[model samples]
Target: MVAKIITGKTIGGVIRYNEQKVKHGQAKLLQMGGFAVKNLTVNDKIQIFKQVQKLNKRTKTNTVHISLNFSPKDKVNEFTLQRIAEDYLKGIGFENQPYLLYQHFDAAHPHIHLVTTNITWEGKRIETHNLGKIKSEKTRREIEGRYQLVKAEEQRKQKVNLLQSLEKAAYGKRETKASISNIVQEVIRTYQFASLPELNAVLEQFNVCAYRGEKESDMFKKSGLVYSILDAAGNRVGVPVKASSIYSSPTLPRLEKMFFRNKEARKQHRETLRGQIQEVLKSCSSLDEFTSRLRPKGIKPVFRINEEGRLYGVTYIDNVNRCVFNGSALGKDLSANSLSARFSLNADLPYDLEREQEVKMGWHGNEPGKRTQLVESSPNSYQTEDPTPYELKQKKKKKRKKRIQ
Candidate 1:
């Protein structure tokens, strides 16, 4: 289970957000705590939470909004969800706080949102600093074990196979708006993309792309964004849907916020992707070979070729981590210029079994022929590699010609 804690100033906004979901049949109130009333209307719930927040006038960000997300594989019933919510609240030091739990049916995953205030009945504010990383993380682990729920970490470790699983938005096959909405919402929630291009790299695999018009256009001036369905050839083929029209309202402002958040959220998985790329590089003789090898490992390599047919950029969409990273972001060694240089040198070389075996045995070890893992290596380390067998053969030919002359 994954718990996301969001601290906001207003409790009404959080309550209304969930209440809106409830009214739309997209969510249901599962449980409530620390209240005398067993059942309450939407307005009553909002007013009660607002009154509670009023007690702690000094606490500007007293409202604590949390979302507990579960893997789709978990068969969580309503009863189990409430129990988990209660235990999670008690575990995270919110046992005495007034909170409401809502089961949201909007996404593919099973998850619930909990809206509560940190203010106590005595008007004391609960400390929320580092709450998500410290307390909530611990509580999440315990709840997962108690309920036998799928661990969030385990879910991340599995290969997602997004290209095969997520169907592209076909304009005429189904309702274009709904198709685009579903794809856009799912990508926004699941993937860690720090920019629109990075996001489009993943979305294009599903035949959808986010579009912003020319810089001088009125829509661009107003910061408008739209989602468009792409044909197989990648040209936009259908009517564009405004970002605000989507259910989640993935507008430019909201997406920009997510971009910042994703940059930090995806840091933990960076080294893993770098390590995978370095491992594949040991035997890959060309860019094509590198792309082919990484695909099986659930990494999609998107290369940007210039008009002159030169490779100028690269991005890796790691399905295992659900993160997108540009080559330069990984490190200077993995950047487009560096990789192009390395591939050029190895272009004529035959695959070396010894190097391939070294990678399979783990790159970093005391074993002979094994090299240090790229994650721990310096940026210039690739330049220090031993000459390939093909290079050695070419040198020998040069020596033979010199001796004959």
Candidate 2:
């Protein structure tokens, strides 16, 4: 069994999430623990949990939401699920707490949502520090052994491939949206990507991406994140949904925090990605060719290209290692500017568009194609042979102005 714990300030949202599933026929209320009445309506259950939570007035974030997920291969029953929930609560120090458990058949796997108050009947909040890493994980392994269920350690190893087994929008259910939400939630929590661009390198593999709006736009300025479904060519196919629309609420602010946290957290794997790049570079000549070779190995080479197609920066996403690194994050030698110079020298070609732009912008001695010194001819004199594209453009504009006048 895999356990997911989410603590919140209020129990209302978590209760409503499961109750809605039950109301929509996607879930069933399996059992109620620490409740006087065995038979209660959804509203009755919600009110009961709220009343218990009101016992403790001190704690702000007092809601404890727990989800226990069984492998799709497991044929778990309502009775077995109830026992699992009870043990999980006891294991995580939530025993004797007013909690409601419901089994949700929303996905291919069998999972239950347990909603309860961390604020005990004695008017004290429960300590949940490192609960997942300590109590929850130990309990999960024990449960897996007792019930002979698929081991979570093995499930975690196959998580990337197991994503394919999730149900879609079929059998009269909207699993597509749920599937996307589940995947994004998992990826954000599991992958160590330092930036949104780096995050996309992982998301793109699942045909999903999170996009912040255009740089100067109001949405981007306000730091908004929109999640979209991508097609095979990497083009977004459906409507770009707001990050807030998803259950996990992976907004830009939340992601920015994750970025900084992951920046240093992911550094340990940089050398592995660098080694992979070095191996590929040994067999490749140009940047384009190197990128093509990396694709088959599930490494995406993202380039920051200027208007003149000059590569200014690069970031590599090594999906196999589940790590992302900016070129300089690995080392200065792998930086875009450094790599560009190396590529030019190795191919025996002129320096790339960076140098080309220098000449165009008059940074070099003279413009490559434009005459620095104009011919000593009269201002009104025209070339007898032919007109250039720019001259033709000027004449057309003049003619259009005359017609307008």
Candidate 3:
């Protein structure tokens, strides 16, 4: 999920961009506050817009391009985009550059619009491909450590893997999807079709389904779909898949109730769950406190991602094995400009009390804020306020003032 942006110069005190173009679109998403930074810092919602202008001048093109490679569609989230950007440029210590991110909707693959200033935040011009590309190699490895991003030349430099070679062979032959789909059919029936719509017709009878994969991840194929076509004994076969490769029931029926479905529904579910989890932490202040909270709600706190199943991306529930908050690869991330930051400081919380106590004391060190638990599942923390014309002007002036000084 990458985005490419074309920035227009500020003319007549205004620069053109999306004017709430998504209000009634197929996916109606509204971001507020530092939503630009928090959500799409690397691509669509880059706050470093000022950098984008510089990038345009430096690159001598109206276009600011980016590629967002992901580790399995299910794992790609807002974090995935940033991780990709960081690997490509930041891992080499390009974090200090001045740049703003944006998005272009001209293609199926959504890439980022990085309008970075050729100059650093301190006004030093950056030479592209200096240490950045080398560091990008490092970032590539780090991201790959967790999940797979598309194989780049750098990885091929490291070793030869089987699937990648096949992919290349398929792609080079032209109509690779058509050529290799023969294998997919032997393993999964979905491969027999040319389009996902055809596959969807088949899933209807078996009550098969499709999901958003992970919110803001890939548009079509979720992570586990590649592994779906098999005998009850479990086997793998497929040419890999595009989002449209697997057809699900009509209207994506059998949709699971996720946090981002209905704005109100997600909000209600997250807020209520956060309150419940927090109370559990606050109540006993011990392992018992963790369990006591869930006992009544019939909710078990999962620490791993595979405890109950893939319901909400939650795997490990508490000892009780009740379905707790499904881990969101993107939902529970922390941000700098906002307060609703949730991090897993307590890796040993569910396993050992002493470890939790040690970690708690080490990180919080008996701070007052530590007494109250901070859960990040709450959804609407980054709402934007309607700024007045004067305030907007003042903000711009202040930015300029800081730049000049």
Candidate 4:
């Protein structure tokens, strides 16, 4: 359920992008910013944007990528995604690019699409360093807070040690943000029951429910956002506790042992699955099968190719609580991972057969041998090989000679 909002000029072209054209543009963009850029190309133009060809497009629209990564490979909910898109102009400096042109959101991970003047509103330059990585990390942290995301792996050892030393206690998910806020804000605030059972006596006031197994997912989405104390501020005492301080109490103390115990087993399970995924690799008979093949093991496959071919990775579609390991993304991940489930994956299978398009559409050689068209900028940058600019130009001459024949 990612929603996208775009602002700027909307240009349309192939259902696909002209990577060759956008490559030249990205080279130029990086040259201007004086920062190295990687895995970039254009997205669908007018048709995909679904706007009028002429200036008919309006300003201030929405677009975003929703993400779900709840359980190992399940997304909790991405009703929408939010982002800010930026296109550099002839000149713009880092300091001046502060302002964003458009902000958008969708159910999954709402994001924004910006059509910025290459030249800043005032002529200057833009600056970006590891733009993708930085943006991804920042977004992840925010989501962790807003959605109560947890680092289940970290709790493995800590929970085990605590279990051995003392009689255990249980607590439910924090109830109200304001009450939690008051307690966390005051360092002196502390509460305790005589023992594990007593903790439940107090928890009774909060009405917390503990869940386990796949059932834990039953209440994952739509759970109210709760407040917690955060420690990043060096606020050892500033707030009593924060979301970062908490581990989701979806499992009660009695059952937590079973759900959170023995990571070695889970680790082995993941390893075995990874090996099995390698065996599952096979050229898909149809596009539908190809997309459907990604689910069972938890991979979300999006169709977008890069200069080398595709740049996507193991993704998730949480609503169904399935992994979206992209078959296309396998080679980059050492060709590991699997897909053993699903029937109907996506509506549009590979390219329409009537066109006789190659099944592996945008796969260019890793080295330069073929040329793709120029495209705009986007995050979906999977690529195949293509010809060197010099070679592509040389091939054009061959085409002319054949035409002369």
Candidate 5:
């Protein structure tokens, strides 16, 4: 079992977060403590929590939000969960405080969230400093022994093995070919991606990318693929290893076959990703908040932006299912254009006003008025406007003027 505690200033925000889950049918109110009323609404809970918070005016960080996560292998039912919650709260000196306990079903594991205030009824604040290390740690251990639950350290080891020991491919730390080969092979064998770019999206997470050279280059014409390690800035850093040289031989032809196979294989799992995204979107008003909220749920949102910083594409990588999906493939509403429009509606400034400010500040590169269009280089890969061709044309013109002079 793993215990995580989050401290906040507003108890209402924490209450609403759990209540929203209940509304979506993803969670249930399992137990309520210290409340005189038997049945209470969301607003009722907030008002009750606020009344206690008002007791200590100086305790700004009064809300204590905790989640107790159990291993999936552990068959913990509601009765056991309630017993653990009650005992754990008492052990942490929060037995007397008013707390709402919720059992969340959104994730694969069995977990319960406890929302309460650290401020007591007597206007005294419970010291939260080192609370996790001193009190919670001791309590968690005692509970584990009492229930015969899987220890947290053992659970972590199991998770690492389940992830196949995958790690970022640092250029100098390991043998380049071997590191890239292991990562690419594991990704190809486990993940479902229909195109090179979708595959690259997953690879980039490990600081590696599959490159086919420039479009006009002979290598690209030959349909050659090379695996290269990416630096911290996403630029290719070491010697590019040919696809044919690797033992697994993940060449273009083989990958193309896998792409066709994966298109159908990953369809059934799309709804799982879509549902998680929709739930997170309900509470988040901005892109950054959306990304942060999804991380704990094992979903990574990859946004493709142009040089002007306009979002052109969005992809979701569902780590739990080992699947990659472009937003449009899931549904029209999940597409980048739709998401951008939603965010604009939630933004403080109007979209046009923000654009005007950006242009005035010269935030959109040197050519402030240049209209950047997204060019679909492939069925799945959306390439933003590349200025290299235009820049080169201007450089050639300067050279000719120098010769004329």
Candidate 6:
């Protein structure tokens, strides 16, 4: 089980979070300890916790909120979960504290949240320092072995090979600082990308982008990193949050070590990426067409284009394999220059019919009576039909009418 302990200055906010979950039908009051009532209601439970908290006036941040998340694969029941929770509290020196234990069904995993006060009957506070790394870690391992639960390290290994669910931004789902931190930690740990550009290739799939400050700035000189959320079209959605401010401090120095390590580690997966690119390129005629075919296969092709509309570089991030690769890493044939030349030869290869309808009509170059065709409009611009002789006469009549007016 994964244990997350959060300390709060007050108990009211902590109680409201779990109680609100129960009110919303997202969780249930599984078990309680050191309370008098046999069948306590939510209000009673809140009152009891608050009453215990009022006993100790010297301690601030006395609230200890812990969430123990068991693997979803485990078939443990409520009784087993309660026993585990009790053992964890005892192991962590919180057995005597007044706490509420809850079972949350909101996530895929089976988890329990325990909320308690650190202050005791004699107005003494419990030691919470190094609780996670020492006491909690030891208890977690003991319970995992005793209950035959899946090891956390093994689960992490399994996650490294699969794509993380990073669905498109929703209408009202607000992104928090914690959510971004979890995403950064997951991506940095799982995906194999050599540099920042390659890392962004993976992060962009999840509407996240990391930035280094302007080239001339002091932060840039210090190799600082900032993270921001991205919109559907890959634009920054809000102000970038600094990496240091995040919980794990995924700063540039840390990512630089990863960059060098990934440079060598990511090389092992290049063949797989190359095979997928080759399969798509052979079946699809143009870059536009190739991308449409690739998306369904969980492979996104990122093209780097120059100011003159020349394809300068290419990168492919395989969501299925959870790997990122620049085109040059694959081979000469898959490089941007080679693919650009290959695509230029087949500019009219069926015109990506499905894409043609979706592409917006727009003006291109400095040409009259001509406009760019939708989707794959390249090499030659399509011209509008010429005016008929009668229409020309009608145009002259209209011009004459305007002059008379």
| lDDT by candidate, in order shown | 0.75, 0.68, 0.32, 0.27, 0.76, 0.69
Candidate 2 C-alpha error for residue 215, in Å: 3.4
Off by over 4 Å in 6: 1-164, 167-172, 175-179, 292-297, 345-405
How displaced is residue 285 in candidate 4, in Å?
25
Clashes of 1: 0
Worst 10 residues of 2 by lDDT: 358-367
Query: Model 6, residue 301: what's the lDDT?
Result: 85
- Minimum summed lDDT over a 10-residue window in model 5 is located at 358-367
Cα lDDT of model 4 by residue, 1-405, tens digit: 121122223233221112222332311111112113333234423232332222222332222211122322223322322211221111112223222122211112222233322223333322333433454445444545555545434322221111121211112222233333223221111121112112222222222211111112222222212222222321111222333333222123322232223222233333444454444446565335655775554432433333443322222121121111223322333221212122222323232221112112111111222222222332322121232454665889899999999
Better of 2 and 3 by TM-score: 2
lDDT of 1: 0.75
Residue 290, model 5, lDDT: 91
| True-structure lDDT of candidate 6 | 0.69
Model 3 Cα lDDT, one tens digit per residue, 79-160: 5555555554465454554333433232222343343334444444445443334544556567666556545444223322
Order of all candidates by TM-score, from best down to worst?
A: 2, 1, 6, 5, 3, 4
Candidates' TM-scores? 0.60, 0.63, 0.25, 0.20, 0.48, 0.55
In what order do the candidates fall by lDDT, top score first?
A: 5, 1, 6, 2, 3, 4
Q: Which stretches of candidate 3 lie over 4 Å from their true place?
A: 1-64, 71-74, 83-89, 101-113, 129-135, 153-405
Output the TM-score of candidate 2: 0.63
Of 2 and 5, the candidate ranking higher by TM-score? 2
Which parts of model 2 are misplaced by more than 4 Å? 1-4, 19-31, 34-41, 56-61, 68-80, 102-112, 119-180, 231-239, 280-315, 327-405
Q: What are the per-residue Cα lDDT tens digits for candidate 2 across 94-171? A: 888878889987664688999887888888878887889998999888888888988887765543332354333221
Return the lDDT, model 6, position 403.
Answer: 100
